[model samples]
Target: MEMAPMTKRDKILLYVVLMLSFIVLYIRFLLIPGIENVQQAKADLTEAQDAQTAMQETILMASVNAADKNTTWGDLQNANAVYYSLLSSDELDTLVTGLELNHNMDPVSLSIGEAGTQNLTGYAAGDNAGQTAAPAGSTAAATDADTDAVTADTVGTTAAGNAILQQILAADLIPQYDQASYFRTSDVTFSCSGDDSDFFALLDDLADNYPSVQLQNFSISTRSYAAADGASVTGNVYNVTLRVVLCDKGGVQP
Candidate 1:
């Protein structure tokens, strides 16, 4: 059989058809698969991100719950009680009253008692039997009975003092102490006497008055004076110097 000659137009048309077919095959078989793979990968990435976010949220919620459980109102109340038990009522009252009377002092500047730095050296030492003797130049000796009486009077004074201290604090007399700020030191001075058998009662009063103020450090010294008639004063006078630090829950102030 003799072969027929092809027309140029027909050959061009045939080539165009073949090219189009190949392009369509490429898109359907190869490119489409790759595109689908990319879409799947993107979907997977989105799902992973969403899951991670959910997990993080869960962890955050758990942390919040834990914190809520840790600091209950009961716990706060207990802490308050424990803190108040360290001082006497009369002492705290006196401190508040004195601060009220002192125009130069800012009552709101009062602070919580400092730890470790607080000192009851002279007071505690004086409570001992041999230590009860009035200092030199004191008019009367501190007898054992007087010492016992003083000790008895001081009992429970710390708690009462703390209660008053809290009231004063709530009143914001010393706004600084109520803040969550750190701790700071303050100096306090007061008077005492060895001659009075009820001298411990006076100490109790002082403790009750300033429960929030810690007696960080203290010194006891004697003083002498004359009566209005110019007669020599017959009693022992005590002067006390105290160093105290005020602290907050967060720590000491910088």
Candidate 2:
């Protein structure tokens, strides 16, 4: 027997099923994957932009820090040059003379000893506290009585003083003392008579202008004066003796 042909209703049902299958395949294989690919591209682009921004920020910060470091280093060099510049015997004398004249300190006397290797232990022991050894080939020195008097006047017996001395000892002074080979050590003793203000002003000048000078010992006493007309002066006069250690950066050993 022969098969019969399909009617219009069956044909329309078969066509509708095929169209539905096509729609499903397009959504699964083409449209959904395309949508996912677009999302992934967007994520990668965002990540790259973030990384670029971070790199730019890093570069900018590094440049700024370099500039700051260079400026700081330059400033330090300038300060060192001013404070640590070497001085010869003549230069030291000139500096002392200038200080005397600038402060109007009368009866100023300065004695500069020859350069020598600094004795760290002896210095800390108060061996060179109030006196400077005479220049080479000279046996002269401050009297032992004067040294004792200065020590008694300046370095009193106090707990605080002892603690400070201990701290100085613990500060690794030897290495710091020997760090530079160019250091030329000298002991300078100077005495002056002036008002109290003059003494402090002179100290401030030394501190601000000369960083390598260390005050070892000092003594201050009141001195009475009589005018030429046989009348007593109204104000007090201070006689000050100071022993200082001067370290020059570059100078002749003598």
Candidate 3:
């Protein structure tokens, strides 16, 4: 027996089957991958655009802040940096010696007291508003009987309160006060002898050079002495007390 001849309907059906398989392969291998690639490219482009926008905004803000005349943002930042600049004991002494030498003055004594913290609350004028809580390392100087009696009469209450204040500061118990508000102060007593004019000039220079160091007390007196040869010498002597203050508002590290 012989097989029957192929029909047109059978041929058309075979072509249709082949076309369907080709379409499925094209979509699975090529079309789907191309669509995914395009989607990823779009996402990356969006991220880059967002980053560029943020950069531009930052630059614009900086320019605006830099244009201010009275108080520029850069100046404020510099002030903050200076506010936190602390002076060590050796540096403080060097600074004082430099000033004395510049003013042609003879230094009699220079003492750098221990650094202490200020009281958060204020006191009345006679109640020792200016007194601070001495740090733990500070030692009270010994006084003679007569001087001790006078000191107790004048500052006994102040000293007692300062003791309590020191404990509070050591324990971090100050209410409504944080570390940011903490400021350290080191007292300096500098005694020197020079011409009155030179001493005044030195004070002016000190103010200009070190704004952080402030003059708290100033005393001047006349000194008369007899030399070995019996000749008398007279001059002016200056006793100055200064306070150097520092803060951590700029987030400076130790």
Q: Identify the leading candidate in terms of TM-score.
A: 3
In candidate 3, list every pair of residues with a backbone clash: none
Report residue 170 deviation for candidate 2 (angstroms).
Answer: 18
Q: Report the C-alpha lDDT of model 2 over 1-254, residue by residue, as the tens digit.
A: 97688899989999999999999999999999999999999999999999999999989899897886576445333322323344567866776667766876754467887756543222344434432221222122122222111111132122122222223223433234342333346667776666778878877665444433556667776655564466765554443333333334334221
Top model by lDDT, which number?
Answer: 3
**lDDT score at residue 36, model 1, on the 0-100 scale:** 99
Cα lDDT tens digits for candidate 1, 115-227: 33322222343332232111222212222121111121233223332233334334433344432232233455554434443444444544544433434343344455564
Task: Identify the runs in model 2 with alpha carbons over 4 angstroms from their true place.
Answer: 1-80, 84-86, 119-180, 223-254
- For model 1 the TM-score comes to 0.38
**Candidate 2: lDDT of 99?**
72
If scored against the real structure, what TM-score would every candidate get? 0.38, 0.37, 0.43
Task: Estimate every model's Cα lDDT from 0 to 1.
Answer: 0.43, 0.51, 0.60
List model 3 lDDT by residue over 1-254, tens digit each.
99788799989999999999999999999999999999999999999999999999989888675565234323333323323246678977987878888898878789999877764322323233444433443223111112111110122112222333344444433343353246677889988877889999988865544534567788998887453467777877789998766554343221
